[model samples]
Target: MDSINVSELVERLGSDEDAVRKMAVFKLQGCVLDPSFADVFILEDGLTKLRHLTLHATGNTLAYSLTSFSRLLEVDKGWEYVNQDLVERVVELVVTHPLVNILRGAMSILVFIVSHPYTASNRISQPDSFGFRALQPAMTVYPQFLEMLVSRLSSADHALCANALLLINSLMREAITNDSEADWPKFIKQLQDLDVIKAVYTLMQSTALQDLSHPLIEFQALTKVLLRKWRDVPVDLNKSDHRRALKSIHLASNPERVTTPVDDGEEGSKKRHNPEKWRRLGFESETPAWEFEEVGYLGMMDLTEYVRQQEDGFPKLLLEQSTKLSEQRCPIARASLAVTSILCEHFEIEKADVDDAKIQLSFESRTNFDKVFKPLILQWSLLHTAGLQAFFRLWQTTGAETEDFMKIADLVRILLEAVVGGATRVSDVHEVETEIQQFELARLRHLQMELLELTYEDHWGHHLGQMRDELDHEALQFVKEQRIRCLLAGAWFSNGHGHKSDNVAVAKQDLNPSNPTSQRYAKLAHNRRFLHYADFDVRDDEEPDLEGLVEKIDLTTVSSVVLAPSEPSSSTTTLKATHKFISTRKVTIYGYLLANSRPASPKIHPRMGSTATKTPRKEVTLLTLHPQTQSLAAEWLDGLLMLLNYKPITDETKRLIAMVQDYGLKIRLLNVRFDDMALAGDSPEIPSREGLDEDYYYDILGN
Candidate 1:
């Protein structure tokens, strides 16, 4: 309908003739569905006329007016004109109205008003304004309304039950937002008094509602909310009857297993000791040991068994629901799994055991579980974070052994594929000028590092190499820093233990006490006090004479890098001042470079000179550069690690490197420079470097 027709209908709503007003309201109800008509209707004071009709009109007219108001209130602007008075009138109608149609319409208006208070401006300003308006009508009547809704849950009409479920869910959610911590328990107690849980559970287990997906899904959501809220409420085990009922439910849900009968024959004995049998039960028994009485004891105990051993609680009820829902392949199954995972976390249950139990309980076999969960993990966006947590825990547990190593390898491959997919999406953008595009690129790089860490072992080198070959080198750094981190985490750096070095080459030099140049050189080198030439080229022919500097000052006793007290214009000036004074000026630092060096044992002489004694050793630092800014140093370090092809020495070091990559330590490195700049209260002035723009830098770095 057009705006002119809608305006004409609104005018007719004020007609003296009852049939004319009823017809106008019926026509306007359909008209209000169109946004333009609704805008025009509201503009023509249609809500005032509708309010009158809701009070004076009967039957279909009242229903149509309520329905129109519900439709109009859906628009965000519509709520601006809605006041507490209108909400109270609707709540009154909901309480007094006996007709199903009027009740549904009135309840729907309340639903839209209270649905997401944050979505409507006026509602947020007064936090749960609609809920308070609806429920504040003499306390007794509001409880009656709640009881009325709960009673509808058991009604034969599916539509009534569904509407009732939706409104209850909305009201419960609003209560959680508005209700204070102290009052929350009282509110829950009120719900229990009305038998709300019983009614919802009836709807959940009702075979009649099984085909009705909408109501069933809403029921599942309601169950999750109730479980989450009730988790904090302490269980009352003081009552003997309640405890007995709880124990009965727990035993019924988790029955003791029936042990297999042992036969005296050779075939039965072989069957009892079969490795495949133990493996199928989630054990890693390659060969049967006759010495051990209980072979698969630890493996057989899962989360369910652990929970059963503890005192009976509400989680057992949720676990039962989850197990039953697992038989279905709908959204409710996913919801059930998510709720169970959350409960497990709340109870401080071991994630690995929970994952194992989830798989064992949900699927008929390991292969079936793998087939279902593998795709879910690959499509992780479809799963909730709780579900993902469970899946990752399972993967971590299974991946620790050789039995399910292929599955772990496949998971690594899937993660790599996701990284590649992210990069592909970034590349697909026409110009990577938007912050979102940059974020996508960064997210992908992070994914790459995580994958690198997961496959840090040498056995998974082929997968890592494959990913490296497939990824764009210009875009992705290819785990170069992670490899260097692994090397640093090893004993070589941490404990000063040496490994076989392949990067640096040291020249053999004779330490002769009689020759002054050789003696000074040995003394200076032994003292470990030398200045790093920042601008010195390895190809430079005019190197500083260490013997000449050593004669000027006793360099043997110095134990730190000596710098010029004043800023030097050239390396020559800095080298000349090495014997004068120590300086603390901060310079632009880069990174460290590792070089292969052979160790020489010292043979002390009476004249403060040592002879060269050859000893086998590994790598040593060729040069060390202190970082003025962490981010720049990280980039330089990554470049060096990539160029040098460093690898971690120990498995523990590899794990630590993997953890570092997983935490995005490289990304964190950028924060140091930004924080320093922030502390200095200065905006970064970009140097005139090629392929750099100030605006582009701000676009990427700014929020």
Candidate 2:
């Protein structure tokens, strides 16, 4: 294809015809791809034209222009063409573009410019050079760029988010690997000030990346460079205390509390009548007319103030966000847990840096552990069973990734031991109860006991032994003895640890099968009234029997009650009494009440419809009833719906609770019928069927 005229194409870029402008951009893309042609094009001021199109063009036109501009740097000596103006224009495009492709293209050009081998060193030492001018502005506005990228990482478009991550990774790689090494420390400190580390950590956690190998590698490298202690660098206590001093000054000078008080003439005249005032007021007094000393009164720092100053910083934000995110079951939940663990680990390692011989954790480390890890553990105990199981699974899978996952494994181990220790604290039981609310304390106590039972096996016992080897033997022995005492007191599994058993075992009565009393009891049990479907033949005989072949249906199998099957084909198959019984697995059973039965003994006949061959078929009853049974049928349907909706105390319910409390799974109860209404000291009331409305006890048998 013949190349378009450079001057004409440049003019055509501003043409009213969109097609001519796109054709000009397409020709420029071809020119930028070839080094010889790119040099000629740059001589013709093509870079300026492309930058204009990148800013003013809309949609794919802007995206294509960005791509062409990025390709200019693929040639040797391409760094000379870059300048501060071009950098600003590209950054603006990156920040403002609504389209992902445009954003990606702008990010690519930015990364390409920033990652050039000459850009970092030249920007620091030779600020007047072209490379320096291009790169210095990018480094200056990095915090804003970082915030934008972090926000993009949570974007719904995964591909756009991936591009954003790639750009960040490129910047991090350049920052750490630059050979100048002079300004790297200052740059890293700036990154920390922007909270880039925490933001990236959060982004990585919340994203749905299938394979985190690349991003994790980049993050681990960044951490190794950024998390280290600065050698021989003295702490700048002046900068650290600047914020507090400003706050204090602002408080002292606040006009709301420091207004000048005006004296009324009556009081002034009365004071002037005194002898001392008359002697001092020769009209030339050394003291001021009104004392303003009260305005300068600033109180000394109280205990609460000191604590608030310490707690109101980044630590507080971390604790609050981590607590809230830990209870969620999204992909980010584990990441949140992992990041919290890493942060706590970093603090511990920092505290230990002061003393080489110290094996015990410093007070600061212990305090941070309590702040970051304890609330998360407590919240997890209440809500997330899936998270707990995933934590344990990660611990088990840490062998292949020894260095990578060791911190996570250690944190989980510490949480488990802490739970056990807290549960078995006999001396602090009363104090612990007093510190928190009664309800939360009881919940914590219950969770601790449940976890103790779950962790009593061989794998957990081995883990405990490993933890014991790391701690002092005397301390370990004391904890073990306390655990034994708690277990023997029946407190580990039972709610009431201090209460005595009410009764001993009683003797069992023997049943004589031949006795009339035993036979009568057996007959009653066998003939008990259970709601069921009675199947019979649909022969051309006179009428179907109301009581024929009956099959029992467990009320627990019923998940929901719909008015009828939604199948349009079956809408005309029955009368107005049609209803359905939906199972937990979503199997639909169509049935309606018979119209000829007695009111006391309501009967239901199965209406046949769609059936899956794999499902065990419920027997279809062919019964007919009188018109009076319709009301009884409606009552039975309403009662069954109500009963199915009520939460029951079955083994499945117990298993679900255990899963949530012990495993941190995200299972929640769907049918919430009762609240924890009983007071802490009230006797538990047993529910009975006597207080129910009339519809609840509709008899299904004509005994």
Candidate 3:
């Protein structure tokens, strides 16, 4: 379609006769699909003409006009012509239009506007831009829009249903990308309120649809966002309402497993015996040892070890049943597992059930249940904060009243009590004192084991009794130590800070301790009294001694912690020179308390017949943590960061801190806070302000 043809059709769009206008719009819809048609249409001012049709035109005229607009808007530059008024009219059409074609056309225009990268970016950076203005009414009337889409998901028209799913998928993708950190949780809650999950799940199960892939993909995406939102939002343990909110979005129950009959042919036999297929289904391969040797040494060794480990028929059966319970291929099953994985990740479980199924299925079994459930019970007893939150989220999501899940629930309650008790013990002090000593490790161990063993009368009980009888001192001691560490770390990070005596030793490098950095310590010139009054005095001969002063920073008042720049002389030196002069690693602690100048003595000096001012002045304090070793500096830096950045005072923070501590302890670091620390030498240099105007400097310097 040339510009001349587009201009001719556009002129006919304003004709007095209704038939001529309708024919012009229908033909223009096809023309607008051409890339060059948008420019000529814009030049002809066709958007303004289409805006009129959208508001007044009905039936095919409105639909075709919308189609033309939708196509024109596909061009990146076309968004500049869209305005808030046109968007409102299209949204109105979406709400009041009776024909499915008109509604879909309007929605298609919206989808193009919203999902465009340029428009989505502008939504945040330039809220008053055309794209954002267009989105306002659509967002305002989103509830009705969502309802319409949900209703269309159940429509008998396959094309309408698919379009609805496509629109929904696009909207969700945009929401996840753009609004994830903003209003994503609210958006997710809205989806739940409308039962979009139920509708989508129903659509997935519909056999009338020739291909289930599109709906399945949409369902998976929805599940991903829900799981992501749930993980992002922490649940308050103290609030019953917060815990109850997790149960609001119930996923469809897991589909029952059914065995399909096999054909009595060579192909059927090959399918039944396929090792790769068995592995994909989460089962042990039936391939022979010779076949394993054909792979390689590493593969053969791995298979050999796995096969040897599952020698017992009972254990093999349990593994097979557990694998079946997880059900990898089903979309609903994968979603359920994802929910479980999110719970596990939040809880800080050491080994989460990612794609592989674990012993979780054992909890559902009644026959020889204790044997199956014992390991998991013991593992849960030693869980970190993340693990506990995982368990809590799982308990809430499943709403399971089963004895096994109840055990997790009970563990959560007990852990909460421990946290509260820890907090209560330190409520009187500014910092944790003897609370670590006060916590009876043995009693806590016994309590945890008691809780974990409550549901198990057979295997766990008998196993403990046998171990006691055999006097397995080393094994029992190991378990006791692990349980104590888990409980104490969980409780301490949840409520208590480190011990008051737990100060990290550091050296002050910016100024010598013997000569205080405070200006108040500077000697005053008695001869120049006017200069002293003007705060510009020369130093006197006699300097007040501050040789033995010791500086100690109380970390509780620290507002920010930042790494200080390392000296270029040390960092850029050759290997031998670098060894000779080791770089001094430092971290700056900013706090109001640290800003107070050192107090001067009231006693007069005999030589000058005067005393320095006793009053302290407030200034920006830069207390650098200078440790002898890099690792020591990293340890303190990480600890201060974790301390300063900790907020919201929720159970989730407790679990995370506990997880860090647990991992650090396992690795045998100096402290639990030694995460990966970036060297200040590697940081980018700040841009110098040499070319700035004098006024800019004055503004910055507060002149």
Estimated TM-score for each candidate: 0.36, 0.33, 0.36
**Between the candidate structures 1 and 2, which one is better when assessed by lDDT?**
1
lDDT of 3 by residue, 1-703 (tens): 5435777777888888888999999988887767776777878888778768866788888888888888887765467556676677777776666788887788777767666664467767656444333465665865486676667777776766776676666666666656635465566557657777666655544454343344434445345444444444443424454433221211111112344456664343222222233333222332222222222222222222332333453233334444543332222112222224433443333433322222333233333222211122111112222232334344444443334443444444454345323442113221222332243444544465554445332334554355444444433334334433332221101101111111122112233223212121211122211001111123334433323113334333333444554322312211111111125454444432212343223333345322323453222332443445544444444433433332212233334445544333323222222121212124546789888867643345555
By descending lDDT, how would the candidates be arranged?
Answer: 3, 1, 2
Candidate 3 minimal-lDDT segment of 10 residues: 491-500
Clash tally, candidates in order:
1, 14, 7
Q: Whose lDDT is higher: candidate 2's or candidate 3's?
A: 3
Writing each residue's lDDT as its tens digit, candidate 2 over 203-273 gives: 44442433332443345444534333332122222443433632452233221222333466443222222
| Pairwise TM-score winner, candidates 2 and 3 | 3
State candidate 2's TM-score.
Answer: 0.33
Per-candidate Cα lDDT values, in order, are 0.44, 0.41, 0.44
Give the per-residue lDDT of model 1 (tens digit) for 1-703: 5334666787899999878988888877776777877777778888788877875678888888888778777664466555666676777776777788888788778788767456466545765355634455533545577777778777787776777777777777667657775565566557768887667655544555433334444444444454445433333445453345334433544433444555755443222332233222222343222211221111111222333433353244344433432222112222223323333343232322323443443544422322212111111122232232333343434433334434333443343345323332113222211222123434544555565455353333454455444443422344554434422331111111121111112112222223111110111222323321212212233444444322211222111221223322211211111222112221121111112323343333344232223443222222223333333233333323332332322233344445544454434333343234343345657676888657653345656
